[model samples]
Every structure is written in structure tokens, then in C-alpha cells.
Target: MATFTPPPTDTMRAKLLLAAREEFAAVGITGARIERIAASSSSNKAQIFHYFGSKEGLFDALYAQTLAETLALVPLDAEDLPEYAGRLHDAAVQRPWAQRLVTWYRLERGDAAPMEAVVASNAEAVAEIERAQRAGVLPRTLRPAVLLGLVVHLAAFWSETSPEFDTLVTAMMPARRRQVVVDAVAALVRR
Candidate 1:
């Protein structure tokens, strides 16, 4: 007789995470069901509880992982704020689930501790902006944090804010929307 073996724990955990991400993105934390996640992952509810403790715990793990991935994929280039904003915009468009996850986090878990990596990365970007200001590359009138906030917001405008605006943009050619983002960022950051 052939021996029978089970799949690895890590593999099951990864599937669970992926299924959870899709579920959370579609319906958010409050609406997501453990049964559905387990069904989608080809695992059981007991395994999810064993791996993540609870639904909230699973969401927290997913949030942290998403934040780390975002930081790795979208590093700031303070010397070129326009380019940075464009890259941020592209990333937001490519991985829209990240934006939805953030929305869900803000709506459902406002009191949760923020991902440290995101905070640290934002602070580093602010410092870089200040350095660029001192070097006469960027304007010194705006506060560093405010400038960073504006750039980040502009990049995420289409994804996270204003469904009506998104509808209007959707009617335009894709390149036009992309150019609009690039031009807007350039205009905002120009000295």
C-alpha cells in the first residue's frame, strides 16, 4: 500500500490568506464569513482558527502582510515626487485589493495598531522630502507631511475616493487617465 501524506501547514496557510484577502476585499471584515473562506481555501474552519486564532486575527495578519508588500513594491523616490506619485498610482491600479483592504480597516478596525513598516516608511519619505526642499529641488513652503499626504492622496484618488469620479474616468481611454495622474502630480510638485 502507498503511504498517504497531508499538505504542508505553510501551504494551507497561504491558501487561507489568499482566500481571506479575496473575501475581505469583496465584502469587508464585518461581512466576510469563515465558512466561505475555508471553503474557498479547500481547508477547514478548525485549521483557520488554529493558524490565526480568529477572524480578526486573520485580518490583522493579512493587513500586515499587505503593508509590507506595498512598502517593498512602492518605495519612495523623494528626488522625483511626480514619478513617485505615478508609480504609486500604478501600484494602486494594479493591486486594487490593497486599497479596498485599507478602506475596510479604516471602517471596521479604526483602533487597531497601524503597520509599523508603513509608518516608518512614511516618516522616511517625509524626511526625504525635507532634504529635497533644502536642496532647492522641491518647494519649501508646504510642510513635509502635508506634501507627502497630498501626493499619496492624489495617487489613490481614483481607487479609494469618489465613485462618481471613477465612473467618469472609466469612460476615458486608459492612457488618458494615466496621463492625467502624471500631469497632476507633476503640476503639484513643481517648484
Candidate 2:
């Protein structure tokens, strides 16, 4: 049903991606403007449709890119749990858009199979939890999925609602306080 066509130039594609990201970040998917995205990207609306098929298609591509970026920040060999938590905290503060985009996707403004895509994107995180479980790093009483959900949700919750989130929870707290909270969480998780 499809015919072959020349691919859009890399520069053009990059601009469109960047523009789409900004639009989605500002107004969310339901409110995003395809025409404005095209204008800002210096491409035509037709070009966007040609490349992405539809707004949903464009969203899928953008969501995949965002997930990849998030996964990259998570080190595969998480030797130091507190250090990894610190990294996650920093990322949440610096890239709040990342979680907000996912939240928008979860709200599901008519995208096909959006839930499936989100689960698929989370495969790497699930795998990390499994590895932690086998190594006894994660509590045996908790399912890997549950534990992983807790980690992500906890970070997201603090990032979104806590007035003191960035300055207190996410920032590199003074060394003494960092240990106090890290130990507190370790105790709670182990309980």
C-alpha cells in the first residue's frame, strides 16, 4: 500500500523532532499543533505526515527517543545503589519533561496501543530489577515489577508534587543528610 519515497534530509528530520518535542512538552499531545510544529521546524505539514504518518506515529517515535535517553542514564552495572539514586534524582530535576511526556502518554489521547509501547519501552528497567533480585540486591518479598514501579513512581512523585523537591530531595544534599536519607530508604525497603 506504500510507495517508495526519498527520506527527508537528516537536518530537516532533526528540526522536526526538536520542534515536536518542544510543542509536546509545552502543550502535551492533545494540545500540540502540527502546523506550528511544521512552521517552527521549517518543514511543511505534508512532510511531517509523510515522515510520521500521523500525530500518533510522531508521538510513538518521540516516546521511543525519550525512553532511550532515560535508559542511557541508568548504568547497567549499578554497583552503588545510593549513587544510582543520586543520578536518578539529578535527572528527574534536570529533565522533568521526560516524566511529564510519559504521563501524557499514559493519559492516552487516542493513540493506538500506547500502553503496549510503554510496557515494551520499560523492558530494560524490568531486566535491571530482575538482575537485582537474583543478586539479592532487591528485596525478595517484593516482585521485580513492583519494586521497579516503586522506584520510578517515588522519583516521579517527589519531582512533581514536592515543593522542596529540587533543592532538597534531588540536589546533592550535604554528605551527612544524603547518608541519613539513603540509609532510611534502605531500611524501609528492606523492612
Candidate 3:
């Protein structure tokens, strides 16, 4: 199940979540160790089971929290999608672990039940894009969902680039990297 709410108020639960984030990011869900997470957080196995039900549950909680934090940091501006993409790229650059955690989530839980928080977040953004399109703010050539997908993917260009890509753009500054994302989205959503 997905964690749709903020993290638990209890201190132990919060610590476990914090510790699990790093552990899970480092080794991924399949390779993560409950014992290490428990010990790192100064908690124990029984406490982890009690708080999150299982390792998968702990991952869901962390992933949900991560998504919430990112959304709160850079909310969708459907009418200003280029800036939104640039902001997302900046956030990803600052919080590389968030990207790693998301990568692990997609790899490990691709077949799992839909995350309620993710579904709700994407739904809200899509609705906003639709509203913008109706008002002739965003282009209508591409579907809202597809446009959202393109913007998000473009924002992750650097993060998803290959070693060859890194070599080719070795001199690209941070500003240029972010502009690449912003410009791509602008081209896509131009009215």
C-alpha cells in the first residue's frame, strides 16, 4: 500500500524512514537489508515490522515522502511549464538521492499496486494542464498526460544520460543544463 499522508509523528518511525532512505537508495529494494536499516536508525527488526509492516512498506513510505517533498518544492505551473521543468531539473540536481530512490522504485515496484500519492499528484497536474489547454495557455497538439511525461523526462535529461553523454557535454555548466530542459519544454508547449 502507498503512504498517502505525511510521515508518522512518532520519533522512531521518522528515524526509521530517514535511515531507510539512504539504505534503500544505496542497494535498492531487492538488496536492502532490514537489519542494517534498523541498526542504522538505532531501532530493531521488530520495531521496523511494527512501524512499516515490511521492507516494501518502508520503501513505499519513503518514496511517498520523497514525492511529497519534491512536489512541495516545485509545484506544476501548467501555464509556465518551461519554468516548471527548469525548477524540477534544479531540484533533481540538488537532491540526487531523490532521483536514485525514484529509479529504484520504478525498477523494483513496477508490478506493484499503484501508489495513491503518485496517482493523485499526477492527476492534479494533468487536470491543471487540461485547464491551461482549454484556456489556450498550453498547446493542444499533445495530450496533457503526454506533455507532462515529456516535460518530466526532459527535466531528467542529465540524470538519465549515459557515460558517453557525460563525456560529450563535459563543459556544460549547470545553467546550460537547466536551460536545455526549459527550452525543450518551451518548444513543446509553445502556443
RMSD in Å for all candidates? 2.0, 5.5, 5.9
lDDT of 1 by residue, 1-191 (tens): 99978679899889999999999999999999999999999989999999999999999889878877887898888778877878888888899999999899989988878667667877888999899889988887799999989988888877775877766666777566667777887888876
Q: List the residue pairs that clash in candidate 2.
A: none
Query: Residue 16 of model 2: what lDDT?
Result: 81
* Tens digit of per-residue lDDT, candidate 2, span 5-100: 755587777788888888887788879989999999878899889888988778778877887787788653433444555556567667878777
Among these predictions, the greatest lDDT belongs to: 3
Which wins on lDDT, candidate 1 or candidate 2? 1
TM-scores of the candidates are 0.88, 0.76, 0.93
All candidates in order of TM-score, best leading? 3, 1, 2
Task: List candidate 2 stretches off by more than 4 Å.
Answer: 1-8, 76-79, 109-111, 114-118, 162-185
Ranking by lDDT: 3, 1, 2
Computed on alpha carbons, the lDDT of every model, listed in order, comes to 0.86, 0.69, 0.92
Q: State the lDDT at 70 in candidate 3.
A: 97
List runs of model 1 lying over 4 Å from the truth. 1-4
Looking at model 1, which ten-residue stretch has the lowest summed lDDT?
A: 168-177
Which has the greatest TM-score? Answer: 3
